[model samples]
Target: MYIGIPKEIKNHEYRVGLTPASAHELVAHGHKVFVETHAGEGIGFSDDDYRAAGVEVLATADEVFEKAEMIVKVKEPQAIERARLKPHHTLFTYLHLAPDAEQTHDLIKSGATCIAYETVTDTKGGLPLLAPMSAVAGRMSIQAGAHSLEKAKGGRAVLMGGVPGVEPAKVVVIGGGVVGENAAEMAVGMGAEVVILDRNLDVLRRLAKRFDNRLKTVYSTSKALADHVASADLVVGAVLLPGAAAPKLITRELISTMKKGAVIVDVAIDQGGCAETSKATTHAEPTYIVDGIVHYCVANMPGAVARTSTMALNNATLPYALALADKGTKKALEEDKHLLNGLNVCKGRITCEDVSVALDLPYVPAEDMIKEL
Candidate 1:
């Protein structure tokens, strides 16, 4: 099998799909790995580093995409990269297709087998592949929100961890999953007044025990959410619905009622955001004011911490990637139901029920699709 690693081309994205160590592992398995020139340069992995690991360095992304059977990437393919995709290629990456109709349509037209890292599952029903980046984004949400809360950034000029003479800012996390848990942990560590809202009682209970009364855990309700949002100085939208679009829990009307100059860090922006006013922003210009509320909705929040994110992601993705390379996509996915869940598109057919429903496309079960292939 020939695997390719292309430099990420998203705005301010610096993470490479395969680290030098990861390439070495593939090389050890007797697989040929082609890395785009300087793909890992942003993260301190030089072309010599890749060569030491037995990877061939290609001069252009076009060559890597053209020669490799499988294209490994950190982010979704941009328009040009998508155009380069061929029917024989397998794209293994974080394809957030539920929210982006254009990308989904292009992918369908490409006729390539696309496996989304975000949709892969574990035996315990957690998104194993998406966890690392989610954790990174969750922790960074507080950091970004704190910066956005400065007066110069159109915020209330409130400090997250207030001084002895002043009260701390109130932080409301809208979910109790990985993102919400990490966000709450960071906010509480920073001495903020933190409240977590979730509909799942078990999740809320677990969080309450984890925080040990340091933060408040409220049963999520319309009234409860409204009350929390009204008092919150920073609201972190951490809700998710797997491969589906994130529910708009915080509406435009809700934002209008928020405190003047409040900040909202939408960690769920990659899945179309949990707030009505949220739009994907880039690190170049990460915030914008909406109804007097500041929104930090950078879609690739983990990209800002590329080195850490790349290594962490490689830890999660390497095993599955090897499986695909070793056994081939159809055989590997057919053997592992969890990996099969990652299959969004195969042979131009949408195989993920969530993505199909979200995009109003026809659905084909991964099991059924693979058998036909």
Candidate 2:
């Protein structure tokens, strides 16, 4: 297998798909790796570094895309990159296609085999490939929300951890998954009045035990969301629905009724956000005011810490990449049901049920899709 890594072209996105160490391992297994020039430069890996790891460095993304059988990327292909995709290429990346009709159409039209990292499951039914970035985004949500709380940023003038006599800011996390757990942990550590809500009793119970009564765990309900969200100084929208669009749990009316100048960090913005007012923002201009509420909805939060994010992502994705390379795409996915779950689009057809249903497109079982090919 000839694998290609392209430099991310998304605004302010700097993370590379594979790290030098991971590429070296692939080379050791007799696979040729091609990388765009300076693909890892943002994360401190030089062309000489890639050369030492036995990777051929191409000068342009066009050349890299042309030279490899599989295209490994950090973000979804932009319009130009998507145009470069050939029918024979395999695209392995985070494709939040459920919400983006343009991207979904482009991927379907390209006739390439697309595997989304965010949909890949483990035996434990957790998104193994998405978890690392989720963890990063979760922890950063607190940090970003805290910054957005400053008065200059159009937020209520408040400190996350208050002074000796002042009360701390209240934080409400609307999910108890990886993102919510990490956000709660950070908020609790920062001495905020933290409350986490989720529909799953088991998840709520787990969070309650993990926090050890330091934070409140509420059974998520319409009333609970209305009450907690209205009083919260900072709200972290961390809900997810795998490959489907995130539910709009925070309504526009809810935003209007919330405290003036409150902040909302919608971590689910990658899947179109959990807030009605949330639009995808970049790290460049991470916040905007809607109904007097500051919204931080950077779609690629992990890319803000490119070096650490790249290494962490590679640690989780390298094993699967190796399996795909060693056995070929069809054979590898046919062998692992969990990996097959990652298949969103293959050979111009939708293979992910959530994505298909979300987009109102035809659905084909992943097994059947691969078998037919």
Candidate 3:
């Protein structure tokens, strides 16, 4: 099988989908790997490194996209790349199609086998491919929020970890999943008064146990979420609904009641945000003031730390890429039920239920589509 790795073209997104080590492994398995020139450069891997690993380098994205049977990518295809997609071509990436009607329509019309990394489930019902980036984004959420809270950044003129005799900033993290957990960990390490909210009692109990009472675990109800947000110096929106739009837990009215110059890092911005005021921002201009509250809603939080993000993402995604390369998408997905869950769109049909429901489209069973293929 011929596999392609294209340089990410998303605004300020510098992560590459594959690394030299990944190319080496695929080449060892008798699969041809075509990497777009400079794809791994931002991730600190040179073209020579890819060549050393026995992977061929292409000069343009068009060459890689046009030739490869399967394209392994870091992000969803942007408009131009989506136009380049061909029928039956396999696109394996983080396609957050639930909220983007245009992207959904484009993927549906492309007639491609689109497997979203974010939708892939493990045996334990965790998003395997999405977890690594989620972890990165979660950690970065605090870092970004902290910066946004600085006096120079129009924040409440406070530090996350205060000086001697001064109280640290209060951090409220919504959700206790991978994103919220990592956010709480970062905030706690920074000496902030950290509180995490989640509906799952078991998850909250586990977090309480793990944190040794250093952190507060609140049972997330509408009232609880509102109360925490009202007093939070920094609120991290980490909620997710796997392949669906993130729920608007923080309404505009709720944000209006927050402290003046409070910062909100909506990590769920990629899948639409958990805040009513959240709009996708870029790293260049990642924050905006709304109702005296600062909203930091960068869609690609990991992109700010591209090298670390690319390597971490490659580590998590390489195994699945190798599986697809070694066995083909059909054989690998058909054989592994977990991988089949990743199938968002296949042969021009919506195969993921959440995505279909979110977009108000028809949901077709992946097994049924596999049979047709």
Candidate 4:
């Protein structure tokens, strides 16, 4: 099997799909790895490093895409990259297709087998591949929100961890999953008044125990959410619905009534955001004001910390990548039920039920598609 790694071309996105160590592991297993020139340069992995790991360095993304059987990437393929995809190619990456109709249509037209990292599952029903980046984005939410809360950034001149003479800012995290937990952890560590809201009682209970009363855990209700948002200095939108679009929990009307200079860090922006006013921003210009509320909705939050994000992502995705390379895509996915869940599109068919429903496309079960092969 020939595997390809392409340099990410998203705005300010520098995370590479495969680290040198990861490529070395695949090389050791007798798989040929091809990487675009300087793919890992942003993360301190030089071409020499890849060569030392026995990877072939291609000068252009076109060559890598042309020669490799499986294409590994950190982010979704941009328009040009998607155009390079062939029917024989297997794209293994974070394809957030539920929200982006253009990308979805392109992937379908490409007729390539697309496996989304965000949709992969574990035995315990957690998104193993998505968890690493989610944790990174969750922790960074507080850091970004804190910066956005500065007076110069159109936020209330409030410090997250207030001085002895001042009260700390109130932080409301609207979810109790990986993102919300990490966001609340950071906010509490910074001495902010942290509160987490979730509709799941089990999740809320677990979070309550995890935080040990350091933060408040409230059952998510219309009234409760409204009350929390009304007083929150910073709100972290961390909700998710797997491969579906994130629910708009914060409406425009509610946002209009929030504090004049409040900040909203929408970690769920990759899945179309949990706020009505949220739009994907880039690191170059990360915040914008709507109704006098500052919004930090960078779709690729983890890309800002590319080195750490690449290594952490490799830790989770390498095993699966090996499975696909060693056994072939159809055989590998047929063998592992969890990995099969990652199949979003295969052979021009939408294989993820949630994604199909979200996009109003025809649903084709991964098993059904694989069996036909």
Candidate 5:
């Protein structure tokens, strides 16, 4: 199998799909690996680094896309990248297609086998490939929210951990999942008063035990969301519905009621967003004022720390990648039910039910579509 790693082209997305070490493992497995020149340069891995790891360095993305059988990328394919995709290509990356109709249609029209990392499942029914990046985004949400609360950033000018004589700023996390938990962890460590809300009792209990009562874990309700958000200095929208668009829990009316200059970091922006005003922003201009509130909704938060993110993501993706490479996409997916769950599109058909429903497209079961592959 020949695998290609193209430099990520998303705005401020510096993380590469596979690291030098990860590519080396593929080479050791007798698979040929090709990467676009400077793909890993953002993470301080030079072309020589990839060469040292036995990877062929292509001078252009066109050549890499032309030669590779499987395209391993960090972010979704841009318009040009998507145009370059051929029917023979297998794209393995994070494709948040639920919200992007253009991407979904382009993928279908390209007639390639698309496997989304975020939808891939583990034996325990958890999103393994998405977890590492989610953890990174989760932790970063607090850091971003804290910074957004400064006066220069048009925040309320309150410190996260206020002086002993002053009361600490309040932080409200909208979900108690990985993102919410990590955000709460960081906020609590910074000595801010934190409240985490979720609809799941078991998740709340787990978080309660993990935090040891340092942060308040509350049952999430419409009243709770409204009351807590209105009073919070920093609100982290960490809700997720898994392969579906995030529910708009924070309404425009709700934002207008919040304290002036309060900050909101919508971690669920990748899946559209949990807030009505949350639009995808880039690190170049990461925040905007919406109804006098600050919104930090950078779609790729982990990209800020490319080196750490690349390594962490590779650790989680390498195994499944090897499986697909070793057994071939159809065979590998057929063998592993969890991996099969990752197949979003194959042979010009939508294989993921969530995406089919989200995009209102015709559904073809993965099993049926892979047969012709």
Candidate 6:
């Protein structure tokens, strides 16, 4: 099989799909790997490094996309990238298609096999491929939120971790999954009064035990979320529902109740956000003020720290990539039920139930499509 790695073309996106080490592994398995020029540069891997690993370096994305059977990418295909997709091509990436109708339509029309990393599940119902990047985005949410709270940024001018004599800032994190847990960890480490809310009592209990009262866990309700927003200096929106759009936990009315100059980092922006005012922003211009509240809704938060993000993402995706490349998507997914759940769109049919329901498209069983393939 011929594998292609393209440089991410999304705004402010610097992470590449495959690293030299990944290419090396594929080469060892007798698969031909072609990497777009400068794809690994952002993560400090040179073309020479890929060449040294027995991977061919192509001069343009066109060459890589045109020649490879399977294309591995870091993000969903942007408009320009989508135009390059051809029928029967395999796209393996983090395709968050639930909210992006345009991309979903394009992929379906192209008649390509689209396996979304974000939809892949583990035995425990956790999103396997999204976990690494979620961990990165969750931790960075606090760092970005804290920066947005600085006086220079037109924030409330209060420090998250106050001086010895002053009280610390209050942080409210909505969700108790990977993103929420990491956000809470960062906020607590910064000495802020952190409160995490979720509907899951089991998650809340586990968090309570892990933090040992350093961070507070609350049962999430509309009233509880509204009340917490009023007093929070920093609010992190981290809710998720697999391949569905994130629920709006913080409405425009709720923002009005929050203190003036409060900072909100909506880490769930990739899944259409948990905040009513959230819009995908870029790193170059990451924040905007709405209803006297500052919103940092960079859709690709992990992209800002590409080195750390790329390495972490590769760690999670490499094994799956190997499996798919070795056995083909059909064989691998057929054998691994967990991976079959990752199949979103293949051969002009929608396979994931959540994505189909979110987009109001027909849901076809993955087995039906895999058998044909």
Q: What lDDT score is found at residue 333 in candidate 4?
A: 94
Model 1 per-residue lDDT tens digits across residues 195-303: 9999999999999898999999999999999999999999999999999999999999999999999999999999999999999999999999988899999999999
- Candidate 6 Cα lDDT to native: 0.92
Question: What would the per-residue lDDT of candidate 4 be over residues 1-373, giving only the tens digit for each residue?
Answer: 9999999999999999999999999999999999999998988999999999999999999999999999999999999999999999999999999999999999999999999999999999999999999999999999999999999999999999999999999999999999999999999999999999999999998998988999999999999999999899999999999999999999999998899999999999999999999999999999999999999999999999999999999999999999999999989998999999999998899999988999999998898988755
Per-residue lDDT for 1-373 in model 6, tens only? 8999999999889998888998899999999999999998977999999999999999999999999989999999998888888876889999989889999999998888988999888998888899999999999999999999998887999999998999999999999999999999999999999999999999999999999999989999889999998999999999999999888889988998999999999998888998989999999999999988999999899999998998889999989899989998779989998888898999889998888998999999998988877
Stretches off by above 4 angstroms in model 5 are none
What is the TM-score of candidate 4? 0.99
> In model 4, which range of ten residues has the least summed lDDT?
364-373
| TM-scores of the models, in the order given | 0.99, 0.99, 0.98, 0.99, 0.99, 0.99
- lDDT scores for all predictions? 0.95, 0.94, 0.92, 0.95, 0.94, 0.92
**Model 5, 119-169: lDDT tens per residue?**
999888789999999999999999999999999999999999999899999
In terms of lDDT, which candidate is stronger, 1 or 6? 1
In the predicted model 6, the residue pairs found to clash are none
Q: Lowest-lDDT window of 10 residues in candidate 1?
A: 364-373
Clashes of 3: 0
- Alpha carbon lDDT at 325, candidate 1: 95
Q: State the displacement of the C-alpha of residue 82, model 3, in Å, after optimal TM-score superposition.
A: 0.5
Q: Which ten residues in a row have the lowest lDDT in candidate 6?
A: 80-89
Q: In model 5, which range of ten residues has the least summed lDDT?
A: 238-247
